[model samples]
Target: MALAFDEYGRPFIILKEQERKSRLRGLDAQKANIAAGRAVARILRTSLGPKGMDKMLQSPDGDVIISTFSFFLSFSLANDGATILEQMDVDNQIAKLMVELSRSQDYEIGDGTTGVVVMAGSLLEQAEKLLERGIHPLRVAEGYEVASRIAFDHLEKISQKFEFGPDNIEPLVQTCMTTLSSKIVNRCKRALAEIAVKAVLAVADLERKDVNLDLIKVEGKVGGKLEDTELIYGIAVDKDMSHPQMPKRIEDAKIAILTCPFEPPKPKTKHKVDIDTVEKFQTLREQERKYFDDMVQKCKDVGATLVICQWGFDDEANHLLMHRNLPAVRWVGGVELELIAIATGGRIVPRFQELSPEKLGKAGIVREKSFGTTKDRMLYIEQCANSRAVTIFIRGGNKMMIEETKRSLHDALCVARNLIRNNSIVYGGGSAEISCSVAVEAAADRHPGVEQYAIRSFAEALDAIPLALAENSGLPPIDTLTAVKAQQIKENNPFCGIDCNDVGTNDMKEQNVFETLIGKQQQILLATQVVKMILKIDDVISPSEY
Candidate 1:
């Protein structure tokens, strides 16, 4: 009935019940989009500084996420659709933008998701005020571009280069502590920082000037206190032995990494042979058992006390291994196998025929430890040869605490890794922001056009970071910002950032607060670019209705 015949016998279709809706090209669109961006920024602002608060988000199905991540806040609040296929409202569009911004920020740099978002939101908020005062959007964009160059130059000028070694890790450790201050693990920051520094240094590739984070595994268990966490010098396999009679612990173990399975090989084509006599059947069964026994004998001939296989082991092979007093761990994942190969200075043999005495790995000891009331066990392969791979065992009182601790530890570890890669740092607690703001304002004064207003707006946006810090620390934001500016102007100390300590004064360097300059620089660049893009947008189009 939706199709009808025309005069020339041609068919045409009509959508009888359709209705179109559209909104485009006006101040209303700008207002809605800016409002959404501001709303998202407001959510992340309270979680900015060391004294920031956490967000407890509960999903519709009762799942809860306790985090301070800006992307998580944006996802839970603005774009709360059931699925990605749903149409986005104008506000949801802005939320999606922030979500993508934070995702990209996290992937590119491990920290500063909240800081960048809050900064971008502040810029857009300032741009809104300029637009209401009749400043052209293009002029504002031009001004932002100029100010960004000055800010970046100031950043490089202020950053101090660092070195990483046993005696030189104090600065890196302090940076990790600053990164962890806002997280839930601040109570154990000192210990956690030590662990992070050691873990990164252990895996650092001196020639490449990089650390392979994959080599450092983070394993979590819920039972003990958070301070009980320890680092394993080698990889930990989540599985135990393949047979009950196998030795539970093997000291001075020679291990084998096998990618091939233990079961008998299959014929490419389907074929069968029937034996009428019982003696013939018994002979066939004996041949199968001897085949598995021969495989175990090859492992023994190579002096392998422990066997880790990528594929599942046969029961007959397991029995043969148990008989030979060899402990076999079957069904190990490929990733674990690679880590094991790295840890023990061994190679993964893809075929049974390729395994030799030289192919076997060496470990000081291989043991299994049980945890929890149910007695779940994990294999600890420790004291490996030239082992760059290590494991961090995180323990906590409950599931939520463990999750939060892991997140905090990851942030701290990322900062440690960042320093090892670059080693150049700037003072945190808003020291860099205040100094950059002052420099930007000076640069703005030299500009001769309306762009000067936009450059000044950029300077004010930079000030918002320190103001957010003071507000989150429960200090009077306006008064504290005023005092901080006056101190920087009087003493010419770029290190004059808000101090949340005893007097709630301004001195980041004295407080030992610092962060990697790369993250902060990235935040400024990304936030400014996003704000410029948002400012240039004067129209909204929903093409779905058309």
Candidate 2:
């Protein structure tokens, strides 16, 4: 476009405000993209093994987050995508894939997030070397695809059944422990793993191929030790009683889960009611009180010993219920009310007029436990009738620790759920990766040429997992890898993996280390696809073009 003339007849340039920033093209762009990926991988490299350290992230909002590097990376990427506030990197294909893999892995199997990111980064890093040797990206991608299929098949062959019989919870607990190994929850792995395993199993609906995670409520209080975390048979609400005079404990409690509020209903639209006389005002007060009284009476008539309200309970209703020797919890919300109904075999009555004995729920005990003071109390409704819902009470020393522990427990629970759903797992400690890598290389030899070279590169990329584990565990990566490879090759034991904590051993199975076969398969599929996508990207358009 040509320059435009202003009203004063002075010629002026017509262009966007030029912003100055560094630009890269061709080799520089590829290098920057790969470096960005490696940078993410490096952030998580140190937090890989059982002896891994935690990452402490402090945001600009003064919120502190203490979690594993995978969680931090996943969260950061999510925020970046949502806000789009960071400097735009049109060529950072690897970064985009890192986020995609982290999120999808997390959603699919809830573990192996770090492994996915690291392996994807390592694959691209390897591809960079292959590219230098004149191998095309298309050939690399094809080889990766072939190698991924073989790896999946190998994973299936090596996976073992994860049973949950009447007496054996070892496999399930071990799976939970593996998921928690690189997390802060490793500090209380045994106890927390047990809690996680039991929590998932308690609510697992295997016949339906579903595990209702919402049924397992995790309630955190910041005053006790991590060891204090325990699973309750029923729900716990972090709310105090509606009335001070109400009984704090009620055994053999007949519970009522109310959706309607025990108060005067407001007009749906704008309206005016004139109280022209004091007698009219008095009548209004009496009508509201009587309405609340009738509501409380209806609850009592339905054999309700405790009333849990989804909405507000007026002062008149509280006083009436308290005088009637009833324990009432108000403002319980819709979710808890639904959970309570599920736990106690109760039906939710939409209106107070519909109250009946059949709609009332039963609990063994309804008790209020005061934590710090009256203002900080939790209601524990324990021993519900044939309850499938349960609660895990999490206790920690501080806010950050509590949140981190919750995250770790969530991952543990998800892994347990995976085992319950699939009941198949592969040897951990990099055994699966090493075995798959070996198989991929053998398959690569069947197809000679540039494709074979790319296949070999993919095989080499699989070694990065164990290498990372060894490096993070303070062991020599080459030495450990050599020993593991020798054991697997000579003894023909796919279970041979580096026992990093033990220093010089290669028995991950005997050490009770395992990874969900589904998770590993997902990691491979995602990592390879991401690497292939990045390898095929030979051009990087400037952000301004959009």
Candidate 3:
């Protein structure tokens, strides 16, 4: 029978026959996987730093979610394009699994999601080349591994030793922020770092224990200049309650007084009472009075001087005290209360206090004004607190800009978190799919039990990181792979950005230099492996087939 053809008149029969051939091919899977990896990597490339752009994705339900790099990668796979890959019978499970692994790795490492994807693509490309060169997959994998180790060593040497103290933190943050883009992302990173440091310091006294808020202090509005107030004997609430009559100046005042807006007796309930319930009860006048008296007596026992109760004050809480002699002031917003508490230098929860210059992280706040007469003013409240209060403020001329900026900020934050917390993991931006391809390449090499292909596959996988970085740095994947090979041949450093000039030629580290080269080499290898997986998608089949 004559062979059938598709619209392009290609041999459909041969294609179908080839499809049925379960035996492994040299480069097909590698190419397809790499393409997929690169696609994902490209999507996130722009979302790098604070200057990075935001991606807005509209879901099938017409819900729009603003996205950063991490979100974009995740949503992209989960929502839209993933089904296409699955239907292609491209080992949907493996592809999804690998992409997830990449995302997790990126989360851990912070900055390399895009790099991972790009390098995976490159790896697949190189795998094809190696196969053509008559190099077995096993040998390639071995070579790639050797190269990756060297790259990693170089990375360690280049990474500055950063101390996690206040003095050293800023400089380290600055170094991390030193990127090609000149955007607020750097500042955001610094701010986040600072917040992290503060959290660390605040909790240093209570390591290996749950965070305690009791040590944190609360202040009253009347406590002028925290240092001036003395410990008062009773809680006081009074209207027209002025500062101490005898003490003309804050320095003259001897007592720390807390004034509130409510009546003399603050309500205390055996059970937690809702605010509305407290407001509704009319018969509890005596109960309220007793509450004040008890509080005052408690203060007096502690040697407090004056407890004044200011009842039904509009702006402040009414002071409740047992004794009549204590002096306390009351105002609105709990500002005075907070100030006095903080000024006392009492151990208090860190969040309640106003953010101070010293308390701010390495990145400072960036302010912008409202544009186009919008009533909503923009405030950028970026800070880097460890698990506490790091926030990104977005201000722009339009709603779109504000939203986009927020997305970018989120992406930057995620990247920074990953980078700071887990520096060891490898990330493939959108290239996780490429990592899948690299795995397939390994499988292909070992198909029908080719031991050599397996070793080569391992080597190629190792070099994924450097290749990804190079691609991110705008280097061509093929050239980078060739360079790695050349370096291996010459026994030179297979890594990029390594300074070997300091060591003497006779030095043992230099004698092998492979260890030094492995870091960069591994990066490239890992990246290429992913890239290859992303690129090749020629065959489309049902999910069950894979």
Candidates 1 and 3 compared: the better one by TM-score is 1
Candidate 2 lDDT tens digits, 252-357:
8888888876677778999999989999999998998887777777778878988888887656667777787878888886888888898888888788788899
Give a tens-digit lDDT track for model 1, residues 1-546: 257889999987642333312454455667677888888788778877777776666545555545443123223311111111122232477777876666666666777878888888888888888888888888888999999989999999988886669667888888998887777678898888889888888999866779788899888887889999888889888888888667788898898899987656667899998999999999988988888888888889988888898888667667777878878898898998999999999899999989999998999989988787535888999999967999988988876567667767777788888887788899987889999999999998799999999989999999888999989888899998889888998999998888865445567887888898888888888888887777777777565644
Q: Give all candidates' CA lDDT scores.
A: 0.80, 0.79, 0.36
Candidate 1, residue 234: the lDDT equals 95
Model 1 earns a TM-score of 0.90
Which structure among the candidates has the greatest lDDT? 1
Candidate 3 on 426-468: residue-level lDDT in tens?
Answer: 2112122223323344444444534345334544554454444
**lDDT measured at residue 307 in model 2 versus the true structure, 0 to 100:** 82
In TM-score terms, candidate 2 sits at 0.89
Model 3: lowest-lDDT 10 consecutive positions? 229-238
The candidate that wins on TM-score is: 1
Ranking by TM-score: 1, 2, 3
Judged by TM-score relative to the true structure, which candidate is superior, 1 or 2?
1
- Could you tell me how far off, in angstroms, the CA of residue 98 lies in candidate 3 after the best superposition? 3.9
